[model samples]
Target: MKKVTVYLSENTYDVLNNLSSKRKESMSLIARKILEKGLTEEAAKDGIDAVTDAVRRAMRDILKPTEDRLAKLAAKAAVAAATAMYLNTQCIADLGKNNALELYQIARTKAVAYLREKDEEA
Candidate 1:
C-alpha cells in the first residue's frame, strides 16, 4: 500500500479520533472507507453520464427522420395552399366575366351534392 500523509487542523484530528473511538475503528480504516465509497460513487456517476450522452444522441438520431418528414409535409402543404389560392382567384376572374349568380348557384349545388355523397358513404 502507498502511504501518504495529509495535514489537518487540530479540531479535525480530534473529530476523527473521537469518531474512531466511538466506532471502535482506526483513522486509516475511516480514510479507506471514505476513499472506496467515493471511488464507487464516482464510477456510478461516470456510468450515468455515459448513458445520458448515449440517450441524447439516440434521441437526436430518431428525431432526424421525423424532422425530414415534417419538412416535406410543410413543403407540400405550402404548394397545395398556393395552388388553391391561384385556382380560387382564377375562378373569381372567370365568374366576373360570366354571371356571378350563376357561378354561386352552381358551386352551391355541387357542394351540397358532394356532402350528400360523403354522408351516404359514411
Candidate 2:
C-alpha cells in the first residue's frame, strides 16, 4: 500500500477525532476506512456508468441499419406520392371536370386504404 497525506477542516478533524475515541480506533485507521469506502463507491459508480455507456452504444449500433432502412423507405414513399400526384393532375386535365372529380375521389379512397394497411403492418 502507498502512503498518502490529506488535510481536513477543523470541524472535520474534530468529528473524526471524536469518532476515533468513541470507537477506540486510531484516527488514521478511521480515515483509512472512510477513504477506502469512498473510493470503492466511486469505483462502483464508474463501473456502472461504463456499462450503461456500452449498452447504449450497442443499442445504437443495433438500430442503425433499421433506422437507415426506414429513412430509405420514407424517401421512396415521398417520391412515389409525388409521382402519383403529378399523374393524377395530368389525368384530371385530360378528363372532363365532373369525371375528374369522381376519379379523384376513387383514387383518394384507394390511397387512404393503402395507407391504413401499411400503418397496420408497421
Candidate 3:
C-alpha cells in the first residue's frame, strides 16, 4: 500500500471523525472507503459519457450519406423544373396561341402526375 497525506477543513474533519466513531472504524479506513466509492461513481459516469459519444458518432456516420443524397435529389428536381419551364416557354413562342395553350396543359398534367407518383413512392 502507498501512503499519502490529505488536508481537510475543520468542519470536514469533524464530520469524518464522527462518522468513523459511529461506524467503529478508524478515520483512515472511513476516508479510504469514501474516496473509493466516489472514484467508482466518477468512473461509471465517465463510462456512460463515452458510450453516449460513441452512439452519436455512429448515428452521424450512418445518416450522413442519406442526408447528402436527399440534398442532391432536391437540387436535381429544381434543375429539371427550371429546364421544363424554359422548354415550355420556347414551345409557346414557336407554336400559335391555341396550340401553345394545349401543349402547356399537357406539360402541366405530366408534371403533376410525375410528382404524384414520386410522392406515392415516398
Winning model by TM-score: 2
lDDT of 3 at 99: 71
lDDT of 2 by residue, 1-122 (tens): 89889999999999999999999999999999999999999999999999999999999999999999999999999999889887887778686665776677788899888877845546
Residue 69's lDDT in candidate 1: 100
Tens-place lDDT per residue, model 3, 1-122, is 89989999999999999999899999999999999999999999999999999999999999999999999999999999889887887778676666776677788899888867846546
lDDT of 1 by residue, 89-117 (tens): 57877766556556656876896788678
Per-model TM-score versus the true fold:
0.66, 0.73, 0.64
Candidate 1, backbone clash total: 0
Model 3: number of clashes? 0
Question: Looking at model 3, which ten-residue stretch has the lowest summed lDDT?
Answer: 113-122
Pairing residues by index, what is the TM-score of model 2?
Answer: 0.73
Off by over 4 Å in 3: 85-122
